[model samples]
Target: MKNHVLRPLWVAILLVIALLVARKLYVPADFGINGRNFTYGYYRKASVNDWKEFKVKYKGRQYCKECHEENFDSISKSKHRIIQCENCHGPAIDHPDNPEALEIDRSRGLCLRCHADLPYPGSHRNDLPAIDPEEHNPDKACADCHNPHKPDLEG
Candidate 1:
């Protein structure tokens, strides 16, 4: 109870012993808890063998229904059925037998990242069909008048 409470209680016990010796010299020995069913919650047990040796670059939409079954049956019945054929044709992991590594993004800022008009009042992304990106035809390309797999046709 002196040198102003023993100099802030010995500077808070030497700052919790220098943060437990810098968390045992910067924390890594299979970081903690993530085992017996904890999955990726608290990980680094070699991060589940480095996410099972990585390399799974988006093989989904049932692997594009094994070779674009007609653009996966017109994107599984249009309005972009929950959007996926590599989300604007990017990662079909060295795609379409290498259509120049397939990146058909066709910009217009990636279709205004979910069409612009951005109202956002209670948002479920304003029910998605927004436009007005400088009044629609902002110099062409929403696949040149919409045909995102039959997105209400007219292309």
Candidate 2:
């Protein structure tokens, strides 16, 4: 090739070689593909220990059910059975275990997360009941007029 093309090709080759050399020095010893059987082919082996020590925020519905059987039973029977308690109640980081009530989010925005009326043509969102947030009592919280445990019923 001519000097014009040859010069650019040589610079490109040198850049790739420099990148490989820099990666060898900068990359951690434990971060790479251990084998074909390693997690996702390429993974850091130390991440497993990191995950083990990580504190989980949201405990499952069963965790809430351990103490609040009455409320849990009500939710389980209602259409909200598909929804997790922590979805509206925030994370149950240390609920009954720490004897602290989970923070219940009574904001209209919380209900609007699923209940906002945005029904489009040929969509599955129609299954969940939709409401006009502004028209359906702008001043009051949905929980004030409707019980989430029995959401279809009025308060």
TM-score of every candidate relative to the true structure: 0.25, 0.70
Candidate 1 error regions (>4 Å): 1-47, 58-87, 100-113, 121-141, 145-155
Best by lDDT: 2
Identify the leading candidate in terms of TM-score.
2
Residues 1-155, candidate 2, lDDT per residue (tens digit)?
66897899999999999999999999988887777666567878888889999999888989888888998998888888899989988799977666566778889999898789987778777677998988999999887778898888742
lDDT score for candidate 1 against the true structure: 0.79
Q: Clashes in model 2: which pairs?
A: none
TM-score (C-alpha, index-matched) for candidate 2? 0.70
Score residue 20 of candidate 2 by CA lDDT. 100
lDDT per residue as tens, model 1, 17-133: 999999999999877875455565676678688788989777778887886788798777777778887888878886767769877787889778887878989988798878888
> How much is 97 displaced in model 2, in angstroms?
4.4
lDDT of 2 at 27: 94
